[model samples]
Target: MAAQLREILLRTRRHLLLARPGEQPSRLAGEGLDFRELREYTLDDDIRHLNWKSMARIRKPLVNRYNESRQISVGLVYLNSGSLAIGAPVSKKDLAVELLTALSYAAARSGERVSTWFLGADECAYYPPGRRQGDLAERNHALATALEAKGEPADSEQLLRELGPRLRRRSVLFLLGDFMKPLDLSALASRHEIHALILRDRLDEELPGGSFLLEDTGSLRRKEAVIDPAAREHYRRLVREQDAALFEHFRRHGIGWEKFGTSQEPIARLAQYLRRP
Candidate 1:
């Protein structure tokens, strides 16, 4: 039953990922293949895909066998930098894990490769892509562990430096966080096409309209802020500025970006972004 739902989700995702028949390959924010493999050259095959090594071994030219070009490989970075350890209905960290998993699974089932990276403040935890059921279980367990752990602080600029050595093929990357600070994103902005999912709970976006002690559940730290006009405006401006900066960065680098709220609209909003050309 769950497998059926996964298929349904994958098909839905594929439908959202529209591509012209045999036109520009789906490598960007679209459903595309995971890897490009080389197979034995066949008649009517494109000579451009010929592998030189297979030529020596089989005494015949080998051709490229791309994993259906209409799939997109996705890499999700579940950021829990102590900042996202806030809010209700669903914890920010848990929400990030769920959404990232949904996105990854959708891509993976659509004949794409999906990976998860847990950026634990200074370092990263990687779950390499695999089709095996056990591998998927390991990925889920790793993500849950990350959701429980705390991130020291994140420097988005320095992240790609560590990530560059790992990823060989181009893949879509998502950085999910509450993004309350000005993160230097120049490095990652260039290396991979990054999409930032700015996560915010009901309190942050909708505003609860009451004075309550803002507390971090993970750390039990508390701060008192008057939920009045001044505080509201202050927060609104700050969020807008950060959002604008992120948007501008993506635009400048030609990186496709989307922001997901912690409310029920996340999947819908993300689905809309995925539907865009």
Candidate 2:
């Protein structure tokens, strides 16, 4: 079933790729296959792409057929915090993986390289950019495997410290996390175009009525509680406060923010978000 969903996700929403401007010709963008005819050199053309042989033969400065040169790097960073395992219709972790797959595939289809970072409690796992056409599936597979190995709350501060220096300046970064832990994104915000995807569960925010014992997925600790009106209201207020703070931080840093619910269709929501001006 999971494999089927994966294949369907890969095939669906291909139209979004067409909307992407990555295919546009740019003298700074990297060269792609299927060379076009060479033309007279222009001031805007990069000298590195110049065809020295053609210039010598024609006695005129000419550039090669490879005109496109800008290689936009698209990166997805996932927070492997234990809170993400909570699920109502879908697990936050599962939805995150799906969203990453969709984003990576869309970027790859648009001729951009896709990279992923899975930040866990004990350690962080990095997947290098898969620029080649066939590597997308492998990258997604690796991401799926990493998502399955979730643990305690990830060390967001430490992970960011390690990751910031490695990323290319102005690269597009998509951050997926439950946002239970406060993150210091100052360095990342200054260097990268950040898209923050906050994963949440409806069950977590709105407590259901009745007395039940709930166990923490990661710690294996149990707590019995009654979900009275006051308790429910308190939970709602706390959630709102957290969200407000998170949104404020993102706004201050000029990062794009979107909330993904476990009940929502990950790809559709992301596609809609991308379509927004």
Candidate 3:
């Protein structure tokens, strides 16, 4: 496990190194006191920084840019639900950990403070923001250990209640999960910049056509089910509806999201998402 994590970190570092200048994965712009330049307003720009006077003069929506700060805070939340343990060849939990490690390493390498929270149904393990080398190493180890352990069902309410109050600063938050549950993140989105990395498996969307026994990973309960053509179609439709609703909610709340299959490499995909202006 240790060697595997080391390899992932090594690959992540190499990937970051290969990225061209100005395309680094860090997207958290600083809000410093020093004024920078004025640029056209983007959807991602904070409305508080909108230059009303400049907009009235130029007749174009513009926002004030501030000099980037030396350091910024990054919060990573891992939704450790049992369903993440389901995947062929490799589990979603493993993929999530890989992505989490990459993001944490990148942030720490850029001299930004990183905080991590592994939240489950009954437990929550939080590591406060730290920029030191030792702190990053410790966080990676803990993240690996948590992913290997059995996960409980996800409790969205508990997650919001616990994580919301602790994040006093307006930071960049990355939410790693399958997100199969109904979620309302308006409060968090309003306070911070949120990016969601949705991890999923092919099997989640399409089930094989046959009769088989199914088990709920969260409850460890078994049931017999027949997956005929009709059943498969129904399941597919439900999944589509669920995803549509999820994406719509994200759009309405101004949350940036990207979906990654468990079979694919997340480092490159994550970098691409972060490169968005």
Candidate 4:
């Protein structure tokens, strides 16, 4: 079931990427180089890219409006610590990849340069951002291969901490993970705009009363523990609380952000975000 969700995320993001109208600006700035359309000459025009030949043809002046070329630097970074193996509809780890894929496709669709980085248990991989569709495909393949080749979870917090200091540019940075491990967002917030994707598996969603055996993904560790409804309820409450607090912090700092679950239709959310006024 979780596997199917992963496939859906991949397909939906790709579709959105390909279907974007070439005339739309990547964001509110509208300073991109994409050619949008033409309009009658106005006093406040750039006065360049002006069709002088068209003026002779129409015997009138018209202004050429251009949609911004996708120039925003959007980076997708996913954390692959062992703790993400905890969900059902989508394991936290797979969902991380899916989120990265969705965001990458969306950025590319907007002509925003899309780069990707995968910090797995033992390795770190980087894929350069590019405007062509092929770049995303290559990045997706790399993400899949990295997810499959595993050893043990790496220090996710450490990864974020390191990223924070080096990135002083205004790029969109997404950090996908389950906060089962702690992170220093305050440090990251200083350098990059960080949006956190918090993932929770369906199994982690509900807890049945009584003792039950549970299995871990990579480790396959077994545990026979009593299901205290209160404990599960507490877990759910804490997750909600933390999610709100995390976004709140980003908001307070004037950092751009959005959060979604593994079950949500990521395309709609992304389209709405990218197509904002």
lDDT of 4 by residue, 147-211 (tens): 75233554637676445444556677776666544455675567555666656555544566778
Instruction: Show where candidate 2 strays beyond 4 Å.
Output: 19-69
Q: List the residue pairs that clash in candidate 3.
A: none
Greater-TM-score candidate between 3 and 4 = 3
Give the candidate order by descending lDDT. Answer: 3, 2, 1, 4
Q: RMSD, model 2, all Cα superposed? A: 7.9
lDDT of 1 by residue, 147-266 (tens): 564655456655766577777776678777776666666666665677777777766554555678886644658998668887777777777787788677767777676655555545
**Estimated TM-score for each candidate:** 0.67, 0.76, 0.83, 0.66
Residue 166 lDDT in candidate 1: 74
lDDT per model, in order?
0.62, 0.71, 0.79, 0.60
What lDDT score is found at residue 92 in candidate 3?
84
Candidate 4, residue 152: lDDT: 52
Please list the residue runs of candidate 1 whose C-alpha ends up more than 4 Å from where it truly belongs after superposition. 1-73, 133-138, 149-153, 206-211, 216-220
Which of the two candidates, 1 or 4, achieves a greater lDDT against the reference?
1
lDDT of 2 by residue, 212-234 (tens): 99877667688998889998899
Model 3 misplacement above 4 A: 17-21, 26-70, 148-153
Clashes (N, CA, C under 3 Å) per candidate: 7, 7, 0, 9
